[model samples]
Target: MENKTRPEGFEQIFFADGNNLAKAHPVKQDIAKLKIALRQLHHNADLLIDAFIQRCESENVPVDCHMGCQWCCNQAVFASTHEMVVLVDYLERRFSPEVIAEVKEKARLKEEKLTELSPKEVLNTSLPCPLLRKGTCMVYPVRPMGCRIYLSSSEKSCHAKYDNPEDPTVIPKLFDFTLKAGRQLNEGFAASMRDEGLDMKEHRIEHILLKLLESPDKKNEWLQGATIHDNFPFDEV
Candidate 1:
């Protein structure tokens, strides 16, 4: 479906922002600059999403998502390599060593479990994200676009889906326009990275995070045009 509620000229905005991001990091060594550029893109996307939420409220359209509402967390999360790098950087700077170690263990276990499941089984299973803690997301601020854009219009519907994930009859009422716009913007950013000769493949969050945490230098290697996590199984969200 198309983004009916997207702001006018959003396509142009996406193109320009993507090109600017590519320009911001001219060389492979500009990893820091790339992070900054990605952050700016995220910031801008948040503002746009907030505005859309407000518009929905003004129109009497209920948005059931809020802090501490995490029924949707018990599902697969796919993210780009760049997003994983930013998250790894955040974990290193903000979390204590103990917490990082715990996170790594959680990710490792989750990855192992996922590897044993078939793609269909993985989709039907309910597995909490490693970053989730006490009914909240530990990395909400720097979460991937996939997590950022998933919004439900009914809390009860979310609960129904969460409780009966394998029930094809149950479905959450989501904000389609928000998802579409957010995904388009993320694709624009990813396209920019690809244009810069970087591998912009998306992977299952747990698998990619485990690899990145185990070998911190993999981030630099990836930045230098080397591919990592190529063997990890992934499914598009």
Candidate 2:
């Protein structure tokens, strides 16, 4: 995907007002389009993943995912409503009510445990995901797309590579195409929210999670603007 063409929707929001758009760094309309196109390129990532796996097998690249080594799961992950809806549905169908209650309680407890840290610190902490069961992801089959493409090709430190002393995992290969796809998905969702006039500026993981828990139907609401708002259409999880 090139900058010459982008999703029509992308331009609508990224260039909403002349003044607001001008105040920021000057990005030509075409360059801005590239951002959207870059995102759309990952829309069919399932196909890409299958291809990636085939390539990996042929090239002898080892993927380091296994039982009890879920470094990614031990973090405060966030998702768009689409991702949460998928996970919530899977949980409802596969787990019992007790399990669901347990997950929610754990989520609340984890929030308190990490409350004092900055949002980035909270997000970066290596605590077990609220849905982890005995060190395993309860919703592994339906886990978010972000979890699927983070293939660690080595045991070396990714953090150390960047000179970060606290880094625990090394991502020798992150499948950038997948990340591009997610960016597009999020941008598109944010664009849709803008079209519907929603605000999501201050929303963090907690805000989104609370909204999901309060009303699954709330997902239908428009999540727009540079901020997150509590209006528009949604479905209950």
Candidate 3:
């Protein structure tokens, strides 16, 4: 059985934006109901993460991961637009205006470094996440699923170089476990539980995060507890 932590103020990011949406016309009822699916997804994602940790332990992989380690946080990890919408809404509600302004400024700078064609390069450029403040992820509990899964591994995978045959190799085997298990479990979950009919590729994570930052509707509704829903039912993106 999944051991779900009782959600707190910081944990609110995991849930749907219901306060404002409750007022929407009845047409959005199905969308509101999507919270249930998202919750299930989170539960499944948690299981995958547990499996990753267990794999690392079984293999005796040395992981140097810890809190305040923001290296992975810099990269542009992929996530569904649905996830981003939920994340942005939660941040809006939880963060103060000053915090939001600071985050936007950080994102603005990060955005300047990002090229549309090279998302990974931009994300992996060693710059901490725009929302990272004083060595802590400001969005901690509500952070993306990728961010959560990545914590179970060591930092070596982030620095490994399969391209350099001459380089002496001592990197931990954590990435291998995450890659294999992620493919087997996480991918399966996304395929089976995702909302049906949505164009999965239409929203890349970087685009969604950037859009969420800029969208006042999303920002406000987030503060007021609202998120975008597809007019037509769409699969999880």
lDDT of 1 by residue, 1-237 (tens): 111233346665765665576576564656687778778878877887899999999999999898888888888778888888888888888989899899899999998998887876677777889998788778877898889889899999988988988888998899887776777777777776777778877777888899999999998998888888753343332
lDDT of 3 at 70: 58
For each candidate in turn, the TM-score is 0.89, 0.59, 0.61
- Sorted on TM-score, best first, the list reads 1, 3, 2
Give per-residue lDDT, candidate 2, residue 118. Answer: 65
98-213: candidate 3 lDDT, tens digit per residue: 88888777776665665443533442345557767887876665555566556535555644522221243533234544443333332333333223323222233445566677
The residue pairs that clash in candidate 3, if any, are 75-123, 195-235, 195-236, 196-235, 197-235, 198-234, 198-235
TM-score of structure candidate 2 = 0.59
Any idea how many clashes model 1 has?
A: 0
The best candidate in terms of TM-score: 1
lDDT, candidates in the order shown? 0.79, 0.49, 0.49
Q: After superposition, how far is residue 57 of candidate 3 from its true place, in Å?
A: 3.2
* Per-residue accuracy of model 2 over 101-120 as CA lDDT, tens digit each: 88777777776776666655
TM-score of 3: 0.61
* lDDT pick, better of 1 and 3: 1
lDDT of 1 at 162: 84
